[model samples]
Target: MQTLRTDVAIIGAGTAGLSAYRAAKAEGASAIIIEGGAYGTTCARVGCMPSKLLIAAAEAAHAVSLAPRFGVLPHGMEIDGKAVMARVRSERDRFVGFVVDGVHALPEADRLVGHARFIDDGLLQVGEHTRLHAKSVVIATGSTPVVPDALSGLGERLIVNDDVFAWQDLPRSVAVVGSGVIGLELGQALARLGVRVTLYGGSHGSVGPLTDPKLIDEAHRLFGEELHFETQGRVVSATRTDEGVTLRYARADGTHSESTFDYVLAAAGRRPDVANLGLANTSLELDAHGVPRFAADTLQAGTAPVFMAGDANGVFPVLHEAADEGRAAGRNAARFPHVEPVARRAPLAIVFGDPQIAMIGKHHRELTQGTFVTGAVSFEDQGRSRVMLKNHGLGHVYVDRATRRFVGAEWLGPAAEHIGHLLAWSLQMGLSVDDMLAMPFYHPVVEEGLRTALRDAASQLDRKG
Candidate 1:
């Protein structure tokens, strides 16, 4: 029955929730962050950072192994899986330690490591006894890995993205259950490390904002994975065997098949973690997926005063996007009486695949009345891509024909992540084709293609005129 008071209460300490707390603090609002598990986040603990580290190590090992083929053998290439795992663990610990300490250092913020549930509209209960009351609450609890109904008791052996880094010994082979960003990224990483990978997905169609079908095909091809691409094969059941796990799958044509692997990873997707937040007590609405639905501009629950961000709000659910959205949501919640919602640009979705994919703004199908112009240049045409022998993938951009404004850009290449920065800037600034083309990007860099692509898109404007 202890009562606590705050101006804002953040229900998560992950990327989005943490950002929202800081945003509220910056506005001179008092806030307390209630974390269910550990501090840090999926990005810091399991998702982006650790996964990318492993992928980078795998790529480095692959590069060393390929050195002999390039006639540049330095010493020898040998992968001690133990050593790789040790480094991953040590790095994760150091990084997370820093984050934990930093969270504690926030004088404006208070932390509670316990699961929280809403007792009433403005009242929240945490752990066994602590109760808090706040004028406004932000739910940035993020999402959790989805284990399909088909796989029930196949725990431990049937893993997800979070379980990949927990391995003390590497599996010789693994069957990845989804071809989405995390699945493809993890599968490619394992493949590069000499682990046989089989990727299964029901649809070959693109899912994320980087909605390019060709890039996905390139991923399957480059990894040489057993791809159930463009298929109706969905996992029906999983059973733990004496050695590994057996996956039963059903195709669209009603044919059934089975595959056994050292491990089966369910990377299908994630659901918003809104289970015990007590949404039933509030007027806040939820989508069909049982996620809170909020106004995109304000990140408000439409119930005013109450806001949701990150995966809870279902904006983009990416770590970066969550942070950005959380900040906006916090600002709006604290100053809703004085501020008006403004139109922000669409988010960019960057996927780290074999040939990384970076996509931004609207796709060809998303445009309503704006005429679309597209430009594509293969990585084979770039100097750096040639030097690195990464002559696959392509760089492309879309522009509105009327205003000549950049609508979107996508790259599948070594610098796809870096190129995403340029696209994000262009979209945020509403940069015209001419404005983007004028930027002095370095020659021989993948960014040089941005200039060319923008110029090409601009030329289409002239042709139409």
Candidate 2:
């Protein structure tokens, strides 16, 4: 077998792996990256970029449908599903090519195309022939969508994110199996694009882990208008028929129901792709979910020279978090004995459905009612929402009663993503409720709704004192 040596070896050429490779190189280490599948990162190829392309098309279609509300009448609005998907795939491929090309530009010796397995600590065998010895390694193998064993029998009738963007034409009807971020976004988007969509969330009735029960209820009320929501749906079995697929599910009350759809999307969640790496050869102990135990701050696994980053660690699945973790892990792996932990960013998550849902920093469940003050504003009457005809949502802000420091915020309203980022930055800087309210509030803007919430929170803090 061929033998090679490098200062750092990165497994998987996705976002985290590529980021690690660059960081290690910057630290004056000779690094090589091994990738078994496509070189483009998951976000570029399947997850974020492609999904957003579809959402953008869906949003355009929806805007035309809602144009009547603004007294702007356009005739014969029609959706060409095939053309829409064709455009999505075309754009997605372009984005993926950019990432792939970047990898190809690396020195030929630094790019190894094969699956890598650990033979021992700091040693890996690539594919069938080559063995690599490195001083340190970073595992960023990413993740794969999880389809339950019960749905395995459905065969071609099941669709997942990996294949959804490649469909020649949209399904006539689809039953979405999860109400989390992916399910809600796609389900709502498909429905707006004129497909019959049924969404199932099991018993919790929660969408995208919104900590506030009020926000969950509001989401159900709003999104339920666009798509059918079956909160009690728990899948029991699935069968394929000549027409499509039939799904039998149990309700929270022990009742059973059956439905047939042109397709079933298993947006249940994803699992880290760490199983084939032969981690058992290392000192790392994997959990039941096949994730290696690693320090959140340092991204190091135990005391070994091995580090975990991105979805492989199964900590935070968002893209920005993965990039941050990759940089930290790469730096520590290169620095070795001089390793130091980096500070983690405050928690941030967003679900890009209509009236976008978002959570930043602490969740409502984590705060006690007596210890924290809350402020809220309804978009139903907000000036900007009314002007934009998006006047149907709510925003809430939380602050420490004693210190008036902004702890967190959650909102289900127009422009939630933009508002969430503003809150995330403010909380990261340890800004107070009053400090946020002191900022300029532009009139007839959605952000004025945030200003109103901050003002209310400030009043609550004063009352507490």
Candidate 3:
């Protein structure tokens, strides 16, 4: 077997691993990145980039169909599922190619193309012929879609984001299991593109971790207009038939229901891809879920030389967070004994569905009633929303009641993604409600709606004093 040594060995060449590699190399350390899957980060391949491409196509189709509402008469509009998917794949390939090219440009010795598993602490076997000895290791193996055991028997009838994006065509109808970000985005997009979509989830109370009552209600109202939502039930069983797959579930009301679809999308959630990594070879202790307990701020895996980052740690699954975690892990791994802690970015995430859902900084669950005050504005009557014919949803701003400082925000409205970014930046800078309200908000813009929420929060603070 060929033997090699490096200052740092990074497993998984996705966003987190690549970022770690660059950071480690910048620290004047010899780094080797091992990848078993295809190049291009998950975002560029199946997660964000390709999914957005499909969503954009779906939005265009939806826009044309709604032309009549805007005093425009349209005729002969048809969706070619195969062609739509082909363009998505063609464009997706280009993005993936760019990332792949970057890896190819790296020095041959720095890039290893094979599966790597720990032979023991500080030692790894690549495939069967190569051995790697490293001062420290960084794990950024990312995550995989969670398909429930009940649906395992459905086989090919079941689809996840990975399978969906690679399809040459979409099924005529789909049952999307989970009302989380992935489920809501794809389910709505598919429905808009003429696919019959029924979304199933735990309950109609919330989507994902969103806990704001107002935002939750707004999401239900807005998304219900786009797709069929079955939020009262939990999936219990699945079976494959000649036509497709049948899903059976029991509702909260103790009623049983079953439905069949041409395809079933399991968007339940994702689990860290750590099971096959031979973590048992190291002294690292894993939690019940088989995840290593690591410091969120330092990205260090306990007191061991190994570091964990990105989706592999299951801290935050978003791409930007993965990159940041990777850099921190790489830098810390390279500077092991002299490690310095790095602060994590304020949490920010967006769902690209219509009236895009977004959460920034602390969520409602993190804030106590006596400590935090909330201000809100309804887009139902917002000027820009009415003008754009998308005047649906709501926005809420949360602030420290005593200090009037921006704490967090949640919104379900047009341009919530943009609005969320503004709030996230403000919160990161420790800006107060007064500071944000003083910032320029254009007349009749979606952002003005955010200003209203801030002002409301500020006023509530004043009332308390």
Candidate 4:
């Protein structure tokens, strides 16, 4: 058996692992990343990069399709699904290669491609014989798409988000199960591409349990995506026929219904992927949720130097937040780490449905002593909205009346992604409503919506006083 020693050992090569490796190197620690599959996991292989690429292409196709409605008699409107997939896949591969190169460029980090398991509390056994030991370890293995065993029996007839990118042909009709991030993003992407898409939220609302309920109703109205949302949609069953897959589900109403489509995409969400890491052999603790339990700041497992990041740590599974958490874990494992352990600040969540949703900080119910004030500016109210032809969204903000400090901000409209960061930065820096109002946002821009929100918030405070 070959034995190797390192300062830190990171499992998985996804966003969190890559970030943690770099941060460990920045702190002068020798680290190596062990990936079970190819160098890139979900984010590179299918999740973020590839999925977003397809979404962008769909957006383009949608624009072309809508040109006629705007009185512009455009050329023939046709989308070659195979050609689109090929181009998007090639581009995704190139971007993944670039990211891999950047990760490898770190001086003190090494990358290994194979399965790794914990033989003991402090040692990882790769393959049959090679043993790797480190002072600290991070399990950033991330999560995997969950397919109900009954539905999975349909096999190739059914697709998941990971398989959607490889589809050479578009389905004449498709059914999307689940209404989480993966379901919503991919459903809209496919719908805009001209596929007859029906989304099965399975939970009485277009949005999943993780999202605000109000936004759920808005999604159905704007996306025009058909939905079958009901309570008790558990244990879904699917079957394959000559046409395609037929899905049957039951709900709290005691009604059993079925839908047939040329393709069925299961977006039932994800569970942490840590099965083969030999976690059962170690004394490392896991919570009732079956996730590794650790302190939010230190991310340390028990009293050991072993740490957890990304989905394995149970924080929101966003790439940016994972990167930040990875940096924290990497630092906590090092001697001269940046900033002593601190709980993460409020995070920003951007969901890319028809009317995009972005939010940061505490909700109104979470406020204690402060008077809560909120204001919203509709996209229809902005000049830029007319020019850009984006009419179905709004920006809302919540501020503490006494201190003028912003506690929450949400936007549902075009370019919401770009505007969300401004709110994130302001909220993170504890900027007040007055401070945000004083800033000069360029006119005839989506950012003007922010300025208007602040103005309305100030007005609300005045009215309340």
All predictions: root-mean-square deviation over Cα? Answer: 2.7, 1.3, 1.2, 2.9
Report every candidate's CA lDDT.
Answer: 0.76, 0.88, 0.88, 0.76
Cα error, candidate 1, residue 96 (Å): 1.1
Off by over 4 Å in 1: 74-76, 107-109, 207-209, 214-220, 223-232, 251-257, 336-346, 368-370
Model 4 C-alpha lDDT per residue in residues 213-291, reported as the tens digit of each score: 4444555556653333333355367788887887787765677778788878889888888877888778888767566
Candidate 1 TM-score to native: 0.91
Top of the candidates by TM-score: 3
Give per-model TM-scores: 0.91, 0.97, 0.98, 0.91
The clash count for each model shown is 0, 0, 0, 2
C-alpha lDDT of candidate 4 relative to the true structure: 0.76
Quote model 2's TM-score: 0.97
Residue 49 lDDT, candidate 3, scale 0-100: 92
Question: Which window of 10 residues has the lowest lDDT sum in candidate 1?
Answer: 223-232
**Candidate 2 lDDT tens digits, 1-465:** 899999899999988898898888999999999998878999999889988889999999888888899999988688999999999899999999999999999999998989899998889999998999999999999998888776888878898888888888888999899888889989998998889999988667678768797888888889888888887558998899987988888878888888899999998888889889988887787777767787877888878788898988778898999888888778888888567776578788887888898799899999987888789988999998999888988888999988889999889999999999999999999999888888888887999999989989888777767
lDDT for each residue of candidate 1 in 161-242, tens digit (9 for 90 to 100): 8888878867888888777788878877787777777777654434334455565455545544333442336888888998
- Candidate 4 versus truth, CA RMSD in Å, comes to 2.9
Candidate 3 lDDT, 1-465, residue by residue in tens: 899999999999999999999999999999999998888898999889988998999989988987898999997588999998999899999999999999998899898988888888899999877899999999999999998787797878888989888889867999999889889889988998889988888745457557897678767777887788876678888889888988887787888888889999999889999888888887888889888888877878788888998999888899998988889889999999677676677889999999888899999878887899889999889998898888888888899977889999888889988988898899899999999998999998988889889889988888888
Off by over 4 Å in 4: 103-109, 204-211, 225-236, 250-257, 336-339, 342-346, 363-371
With a 3 Å backbone cut-off (N, CA, C), the pairs that clash in candidate 3 are none
Runs in model 2 lying further than 4 Å from the true structure: none
